[model samples]
Target: MNADIKNKIIKYSKEIGIDKIGFASADPFVTMKERLRVQQENGFQSGFEKGTLEERTKPDLLLPQAKTVISIALAYPSKMKNAPRSVKGDRRGIFCRASWGEDYHHVLRRKLNLLEEFITNMYPEERCRSMVDTGELSDRAAAERAGIGWSGKNCAVITPEFGSYVYLGEMITTLSMEEDTPIEDQCGTCNKCVDACPTGALVQGGQLDATKCIAFLTQTKTMLPERYRKKLGNRLYGCDTCQTVCPENKGIDEHRHPEMEPDPEIVKPSLEPLLTISNKEFKNKYGKISGSWRGKKPIQRNALIALAVFKEETSLPSIIKVMNEDPRPVMRGTAVWALKEIAPTAETKHLLQSFKTKEEAPEVLEEVEKALADLSSQGGMYV
Candidate 1:
């Protein structure tokens, strides 16, 4: 019965547009528990993790009488058609590939809900609980255990079919099922991802220091640390440096799902106009995409840094406006830093010095003083 039901579920998953599906016993994730403990102790967690260690690793804790776990993967396009260029005077900032489409949480949840409905219809007395990324159970761990993919050294699940560009979701079920074999690690001795990491966030092959990671850094609502500012490049949301450099992902660009296709302008938007984008405008434009989860502040702040990275002289006025008029202290402080990088001119120094008198926020005032000192040391070149 378990085998027959597993086969039926797999077929139904394919019919529902699931790219890959695998089944596993609802056993506690022993190895993952230890690794997560170490990660917590070392402060390597990104602070976005949802649940306690026990709940995260044990399926039964989440679903009482759980006997099987089902993992599903969906492939998203890696390449954009008609991707817009980021030229000087019209510089742009990027959201990573994972954030290119409608939020995967919504997309995956819909599929999981369908699967749950199918299961309950087949077994009236059985129960199920489904979760995407936000769930207590680790999606990657469940995926790995279910033979959906191997856990790559880059901390991504790398499938032979989809590389590492697949989105994962899982269901814990009361119905017993035969488990699939877990995939063996295929990242042997390849350190390309670690070597190419912008901020050395991939401490070694498999370990990541989330605090130093540009992807995590970009999502923070507070002021970006000076050390990682330049490292951010033009990325406004998540960073895909490690994934891009992986040999496994080199020539793989899936276009299986239309909803996952990127709108080039939305994912890679002009940096200048973002500085003053109203809240309503921002939501209407970017509300559906996963990158907008933190709202427009982080994206706008990253845009400021990105403009500075490019030394976009054309965006100087906008940056100055943000420094002077933006109500958010973080935005004002970031704009001051952007001014220091983009135009450390006599005019900029004068502007900073004058603003310093009226800036009440300690953080923004500190940025103003730093900009003034840096400009003074540079002899304040005229723009």
Candidate 2:
């Protein structure tokens, strides 16, 4: 009966657009519990993680009588075709592959919901609980246990077919099923992902320092530390450097779902107009994408940093406008730094001096002072 049910579910999953599906015993994630404790101790947790370790690792805690975990993966496109160029004057910032297209959370949740309905229709007495990225359970751990993929050195579940460019979701069910064999780690002796990390966020083979990770740092709402600003490059949201450099990911680009297809202009948006985008305009443009979860503040701040990276002289006016008028002090401070870096001049100093008296926020004022000092050292007037 278990084998028959598992076979039926796998067939239904493909019909419902699930790229890969696997089943595993719904036992506590013993190894993962230790890893999570160590991650918390070492301050490597991304803080975006959901639930306590116990609740996350114990399937029965999430759903009583849980006997099997069904893991699902949907491959996403890694490369953007006909992507708009980031040229001079009209520089652009990128949203990472995970944020390209409609949010994966929505996409995966829909798949999970369909799978849950299928299971319930077959076994009416079997209880089931489903969750996507924001769920209490660790999706990667479940995926690994279900033989969906091996956990890569970059900390992503790397499927043989889909590589690492996949969104994961899971369902805990009361029905028991024959479990598949776990995939062996195929990332032997390769250190490309670690070496490729701009921030050295990958502490070792499978561990990551969330504080230093460019991906986590980009999503932060507060002012970014000076040390990580330059490392950001032209990224407006998330960081795919580690995945991009992985050997397993070589030539692995999937475009299965139409909703998952990226709009080149939206994913790589112009930096200047982002500085002045009204809240409603930002929502209208980016609300559907996963990158917009933190709202527009962080994206706009990163845009300023990206503009500075390109030394976009034409965007100086937009930078100055944001610095002088934007209500968010973080945005204003970022603009101040970008203005000096992109087009430092006598006028830049004059603008900094004028804003100094009016800037009441201590953090913004500190940024203003730092930019002033940086400008002065570079031959701009100190006063």
Candidate 3:
């Protein structure tokens, strides 16, 4: 009876657009508990993780009669079709591929709801709980246990069919089902993702130091540490270096779901315009994507850093304009950094000197002082 129901569930999942689905015993994640302890002790957490260690590792704690976990993966497009050009004067910043479409939380939740409905219909007495990324259960851990994929060294669940470009979600159900075995790690001798990481976030094989991770760093609202500014490159939201450099993800571009499609202009938007985007405009343009959950401040700040990385002399006037007028200290301070990097002129020094007198925020004032110190090192290059 369980076998028949499981098979039907799998068929229905595919029919409802779930790219991949697998089942596992709803046993406590004993091994994962140790890993979480280590991650917490080392202060490697990104502070965005949900729930306590017990809640995350124990299945029955969430759903009293849980017998099996149904893990699902939906593949998203890896490459943007006809992506807009990032030219000299009109440079654009990018949101990572994971954030290209509608927020995965919404996409995966809707799919899970459909699966839960199907299960309840088959067995009217059946009870199920569904969760996406923000849920108490670790989506990757559940996916790994359910045989949907193996946990990669880069800390992503990599499926043979979709590489690491899939969004994961899961449902805990009272119905007992035949469980699938976990897959073997195929990463073997490849260390490309570790070596390619701009911030050395990958501590070792299958471990990540989230604090140093560019993806985590990008979401921070305050002044980005000076060291990571250059490492941020053109990324406005999350980092994809680890996935991009992984051997498994090579040539993988899945565009099966239309809702997962990206708008080139919105994902890789013009840098200058982002600096001045109003709250309403930011909402209208980016609210649908997961990257915008942190709001416009982080994205705008990242845009200023990107302009600095490009040394876009053409954008200096715009940078100066924001530095002088923007109310947000983080934005104003970042603009100062960008201004200094783009060949600070005598006029620029005068502007900074004048601004320093009126700048009250210690954070913004510190940035002004640093820019002036850097300008002084140029030895009349700006004078």
Candidate 4:
């Protein structure tokens, strides 16, 4: 690799809004393939609908002529207070802090595309393709190889400068360049991430069981299983319990990157307001939110689920509306599950009883009776 060429590209990359950039020789990552094989064998990414062995192993999927991968990481701005300590309107709510702002995918994609254009301009004979977690490229492996960061046990890429809050972007190229040294894995004996998980999804050895994973349960387009509800705590979207406890995520203000601006609505949308919104309205309020793309049902579903976890019975009116109004029986089922978790009051008891006589959806009715059963066990107390 020419030193002058590498220096010029690196300089241009940083100038194009990427905090850090590095190169890795483009070859089928045999080790990553092997790990992926094991993960598939052991069912690591099993919950993912489109994620498959062939889906992950296709080398040409990332770059048709991939000779080298030019990877960059952008630090997401974050604060400890961003994670919710309570379900009150003041608390931001318990979800991943990274999802709080503008979609990192959009922010990082523009930067990667600019860098790709700049690189292509310099090397007219070569080609570059911008990839932002859209292909088979092993990003964590790429991040590790590029010295951008090492993957934490929670599977988040952690940088010394930005901890684990960096969003990764890649520019696959045919240009051969000098690669950076991979960083050493720093997480040793500390298991704060595992200990802090509300669900025991982090079973062991960097394996994540999506069935028990709160983030997975919330974001997945399918139905959430019954057992994971209370374990979800007040998390309405993705869960960030593991990252918050990691030791490496120290120093919130000093080395923090200043470019990221999280959208205010995602920072903290009110629980009461969520029930009244339709999908069209949801698109208007949350279309830009990372959580919004999944559609209003999941967000509304999780909001009711969270209200139940908080046991804030005062949210019952709105919760009851969502329980009855949501067209998706799956969401309504989860809403009833949330109501049960919140501790049923007399009005809620009557509502549950009323749903029993008139509820048509079998899934919704299954849980409606379960809610009454739950209330009976809890001594009919209003939480």
The most accurate candidate by lDDT is 3
Q: What value of lDDT does candidate 3 attain over all alpha carbons?
A: 0.93
lDDT (tens digit, per residue) of candidate 4 on 96-135: 5666566667878888878878878878898887667655
Instruction: Give candidate 4's TM-score.
Output: 0.89
Q: Tell me the tens digit of each residue's lDDT in model 3 across 169-217.
A: 9999999999999999898999999999999999998888999999999
Candidate number with the higher TM-score (2 or 4): 2
Candidate ranking under TM-score, highest first, comes to 3, 1, 2, 4
lDDT of 2 by residue, 1-383 (tens): 87898889999999999999999899999999998999999988888999998999999999998999999999999999999998997899999999999999999999998889988998899899999889999999999999999998899999999899999999999998999889999899999999989999998988888889999999999999999999999999999999999988999999999999999989999888988888899999999999999998899899999999999898887788888889889999898889888777878888898999999998899999998888788872543
lDDT of 1 by residue, 1-383 (tens): 87889999999999999999999999999988998898899999999999899999999999999999999999988898998899998898999999998999999999999999999999989999999998999998999999999988788999999899999999999999999999999998999998889898888767788988888999999988888899999999998988999899989999887888899999999989999999999999999999999999999999999999999998988888998899999999999999889876777777887888898999888888777777777662542
Q: Evaluate model 1: give its TM-score.
A: 0.98
TM-score of each: 0.98, 0.98, 0.98, 0.89
Candidate 3 lDDT at 11 equals: 92
- Alpha carbon deviation, residue 118, candidate 3 (Å): 0.7
C-alpha displacement of 263 in model 4, angstroms?
A: 4.0
